[model samples]
Target: MKKLILVLVLVMGVFFSGNAQKVPTSEEIAKKNIEEMDKRLKLTPTQRSVIYNYAFDMAKEQLLLYKKQVAGTAKEEDETRIYRLQNEMNKNIKLVLKPDQIDEFNKLNEERLSGIDPGKKKKKKKKGEEEEKVVGIEGLKSTGNN
Candidate 1:
């Protein structure tokens, strides 16, 4: 009976822990972003400071948007706004980077963008199937006549 209770408690703990996610604070997000940039672009102290400021502001904006979305109060334009926010951050970061670092930064951006799908799925056409054209009322009338 003790073993059964222990197993049950362990399973319950795992189930609850698996569903909980902790959101990062703005500072944490900014620190992470600059760390990645430092690793990839070899940023100097001045560049890191400027980029961290940009990243922190972007992260705060993103967190606000995320909260609104979770509360079901987000506008349709909020989706586009997130992209605009990131673009602004990228532009500011580019200004602080050297010419060579800018090339590496662009490549990183491309790699990140490539992973996202545009939320569109094209319908697949079957083999030997011709595309269908819409017929107007006049054309339908002509086809109905023997």
Candidate 2:
């Protein structure tokens, strides 16, 4: 009986631990974001450094907002701030890029915004259930009808 209980406890602990996701740190977020941009834009070392700073700042702000949302303390202003941060980051990134790079950056932004297909309806969740949260930069925008 004791061995059975020990085995059961170990199995339960492993199952719960496996289910828990570790949230990425702001630096991890920034590094991943910059890596994507580098692949698309072929950014120079200097440009990468500057853009990393912007992405890091944006990620930090987003993490704070996420915490508030999880705590059910998110305010309307948080959404507005997210949009503002995205715009600011885009503008700053553009400043660091060449004219050709700027065009590519703009194209990337357009793709990000338009990636969602409007024709498909979202699956309805049961009452009291929350909508699925989008992750990454795209998560800044609401997935519902605008």
Which sections of candidate 2 miss by over 4 Å?
A: 1-20, 116-146
Each model's TM-score?
A: 0.63, 0.65
- Output the TM-score of candidate 1: 0.63
Candidate 1 per-residue C-alpha lDDT over 10-118 given as tens digits, one digit per residue, 9 for 90 to 100 = 3333433564576667798679768877888999999999999998887787667667766899886875676667767787888899999999887765544443222
32-57, model 2: which lDDT tens digit per residue? 77887898899999999999999899
Strongest candidate by lDDT? 2
TM-score, candidate 2, is: 0.65
lDDT of each: 0.66, 0.70
Runs of candidate 1 with Cα error greater than 4 angstroms are 1-21, 116-146
